[model samples]
Target: MQPFDAKPLSDGDEQLLAALLDGMEAGLCAFDRDGVITHWNSEAVRILGWSADDAVGRRGFSGWAARTADAHDVQTRLLGAMDAPGRQVHEFALLTKDGHRVLVRTQSAAVQGQDGRPAGVYCAFSEVHAQIDLERSIALSEALFDDASWGVVLIDADLRPAVVNAHAARLLRTGRDTLLGRPLGDLLEQGLEELETALQHVLAEGSPPVPSELWLSLRGDESAKRHCWRSGFVRLGSPLGEEPVPLGVGWLFLDVTEAKLAEQEGSLLRFRHNQLHRAGRTASECEDPVEAATTYLDFALAGFADHALVDLAGDDGRLVRAASTPEGSSGPCLPVPVGTIPVAYGAAHPVLQAVERIGTVRASFGALAAAEPASRARIDEWAAARRWPEGTVHGLSTVLRSRGRTLGAVTFLRGAGRRLFDRSDAAYAEDVAVRVAAALDLAQQLG
Candidate 1:
């Protein structure tokens, strides 16, 4: 094999190399085998406040770049890398041109010659504090993605999930890779509009002063259960850009569904208690016992349901409608004049079931079919067969009992727009039934 011959670098080549080294972000300096400085880049000059003309011919850092007491050790460590393998890391306290001390971290590597011998060494360095700050930022980012208790998601500028942490992936009920780049609507069954609005607001107007709580439903669940998230958002921008340029948004959230539900339940309970108290006060002033019974029904409808009906047990095991809200729309409960008139409610009706079992009974039309026209006809027929008012989709019947005896049943009806009756609704209806039963028992005794 022929030995390769290398030509010396042209003046243009040297100038180009010098410009490249001068433009580097890290300070760079090269030393010869004889311990003379051969090259000093612009970053090194800027850090030490010395010109390349003065630095390139200096033998070592002693007496100028470093304190005399520390210079010998620093120079020995820097020069030691010339004979060592790979790179060597070291920290040194160096003197700037203005005599201020600056601590720096340096990485030194041996520069090999064509004969496979160490020709010199080159060192790259940056301020120790700056390097430490960079390391801390990287550590924080890693911790957020790996070990955070709350959910963390990095959403791109287009509002798609770019990165999802483990906590966030679990909340989304998906793998991290599956959520990436997918639209927010694809993951959430509802509340996408509100989420996107919040993300866009963060990108355009910066973060809001307070974190927001969002209620959303998940896809592919039969219950269609809703969840509440206490979410915070921050807009990420490009640090390298001259002006603030939006990169994406960072979202952190925690599942607050149970807490929020408890809060709402407490508030609802308080309001219902107040309503019951108010109804008792107003009913006491009524001239007729039946009027007071209707007053209880009117107050119970405030935030519980759209309409209410009170039926009283009549002769031959039949029930008669005693009072009810308006049939066309929501209104105060009025006493029905159907005296001794037994309603044609079948045996299997929810209201009749409640009376027979002495417990609350709940029923709904169940999810409507996709076909609108046919589904509408089916719903109407379903409502009519049960003698419910128009648009009633959900019904709750609580048995009206007074002193261990069943008086009748009171039914609460909700329109198609409202949610189905759950256990909480049953409990509230039972509370109202207690009040209604007392007033009706009094009416029966007085009549």
Candidate 2:
């Protein structure tokens, strides 16, 4: 009911300013020469529980005081600065309109008249001091969600979608627009069955959430089983600045498919490689090259092959088959000609080319057919005898080449479709070839 104005308060202006201050959420008041309340605003009344009519002329420090346990001396220090007018501004607290105390910052200064005489002290109070104390807490919460390595989603207290970050969007394979405001249950169905289970566990447990590995079939397609994720859930504080309680749950999902695949492949490779190493070690202990070659062939056969032939190279562009599993191993160099032995086309012909090339080569039956008509016919004949699909056999050949000369070829015959050799498998095969090449070189030296 008063007009607002700048300094040197008019009765109408003071009344209007008082009305505006009362309307503000922040508290405002002034003190006279005796450090007594001369003006009080409605916010002061609401916050400190003091009516302007009752507070006027009352000792500001004695009759009206606001304090919190955290800042006990703030009000005392502000009022004590009245004697030292040099300190233009001071901050403190006042008793709220209610008996309750709150943290507040006050700007107080001596009010001087035009003649330069000290007339009173004016103080404006604000409540943003509490917000400063909460900054670190807010930052910690943000870090929990943003820095998480897994995909995280926040569901509000009402069970509505509050927020889902980039990771969650990718895991769910949906845009933020499609995810937000939707129920967590609905989204979980569209995402992964594992996600729904995790959600239910969080709701039922009502405790700190747990971690789980989930395989998703959200796409309902051939690729559905490929979608696997590891997830975690934790109850979190509200994003609103209110006093925090567990108002929502955070769900984090991490893609573990690659890690799992790598683990499996590594295990297999290690198993096969270990077998090769053990065989070599055993043969060396016995000082038998023939036994070592037999052992190596067995190990090689265990990898995508039913049979293997480890042979020394002859000057005649043929193999001297030293050892073969199932016995009666023949080659052109031995009683049985290696050139006459039947090989299924494309079944691991790469091993031969690799041996011939003195490097690594990967080939299909077609590649083998292209290499030699006689070799192709031999493979076709074997395929027909086995009553197997011709395409099921691939011939891989790796040359035992050491110091750039072809020492021999360690050949493998892979049965079809049990396992398609990947690049890693090929690389491992190359490594075995190199080792065999070294072994051949050493054998020749011993001879």
Candidate 3:
């Protein structure tokens, strides 16, 4: 019985009303005491295909009769509810304008006159399709959370946890229930600048938030550690009448800790390997023996080595440490005997032999194959034939020269620990040997 205000509502309220109607996902209609349609929303039109033009001045059942037989039943319920006490709800089958049958949940309330008598009926309806749809959606969402290899979390506008999937709960090393509705920043509980930055970025990009990557350091665990993730944001509804606020973000997280570690390790390996590769190529490019060895050594170190020595074959036919450090290291003294002095030469030794014997650039892991009979015999015979000092062992890649001819041979001893190298590492060493051989050949031809 309150006076109706004709004044216009704010754009925000109009938008809010539209949002409310849209949010209902329910078909709604209002009828006067005479059963004439006064208002009908889009959902009603969508379900019945009958708008205000079709039902405003006409009987509700007659116009919608083509849509459903249940229209008469709904009218009966409304008439009874108008005569009776309070509000009521009912479920019934409805036929759409397209001749499709659907289950609908309907609620109707009385609109009172100035005398407090029943004036009309305001009814609202919701299609029950979402009942089954929601259940299936929930099941699938749960499955995704449980089965996913990465972590997932749903947060509120205040960045509070509305839901934390199983994987995310485990990643944080906490229980799902315990973490729910708690502030995400609080849960992180660390002064991680990157994590803070990522969260801020997500919220700053409103509605359909952008995906972001971040590193997290979880605390209050048995052991604190770092975890990386790629996260995203999605908006969720408030209640019913409220404006669609900027809700929290959804995080789709991937654990990339292992991948990152692998990338770093690979980079280091490639750097060392490339040094050897470059050294060999440089040797081949320069034809002078001194120049080739010097160039090869330069490429070998590539600013990575603390020292280097290029031992060329001496006039006495003994493999001698001819080229020493550019930085003037006292080691690899001339005539000190290559057999006694040792350093990690990699596969250059065997590669040297291959190049010498085959008359082409060769490469092998000499120290790695030192246990093999072929390698052992070659090394022993070379050293014994020279009648060199007892400690001197032939480099696996040794540049042997007979009659002013420099044949390639290299002795690769492991530096300090004599670490056992893997295949990839060995392959890198062999590549260097090939380059050194090419250089030696070029040097001989040029001479």
Best lDDT among the predictions, by candidate number: 1
Residue 192 alpha-carbon offset, candidate 3, angstroms: 3.1
- lDDT string for model 2 (50-167, tens) is 6778777666445446444533365455555555656544444445555555656666766665567666667776665554557677886677556656677787656666887766
Residue lDDT tens for model 1, 1-447: 011222467788877888888889899988878667888888998888978887887888888899999988988999899878899999999999999999999999987778877878888999998889999999999999998999999999999999899999999899999999998888987787899999999999998899999988787756677899999999999977789899999999999999998999999889988998999999999988888888888888997889898998986667999889999988999988868878889879999899988999999887532212245677788889999987788899999999888899999998776777888889988988998899889888888
Count steric clashes of candidate 2.
41
Q: Residue 141: error of model 3 in Å?
A: 4.9
| TM-score: model 3 vs. ground truth | 0.47
Q: Compose the digit string of candidate 3's lDDT tens values, residues 269-367.
A: 788777666665664565465566556555554423334335555455444454444333323212123364433334434434444464323222244
Q: Mind sharing the TM-score for model 1? A: 0.91
RMSD of each: 3.6, 12.2, 12.7
Error of 1 at 147 (Å): 1.2
Task: List TM-score per model, in order.
Answer: 0.91, 0.47, 0.47
User: Which residues of candidate 3, in runs, are more than 4 Å off?
Assistant: 1-25, 28-63, 66-123, 127-149, 156-162, 177-191, 207-217, 220-226, 235-244, 259-275, 286-447
Residue 442's lDDT in candidate 1 = 89
Backbone clash pairs for candidate 1 read none
Superposed Cα deviation of residue 339, candidate 3 (Å):
18
Model 3 lowest lDDT segment of ten? 328-337
Give the candidate order by descending lDDT: 1, 2, 3
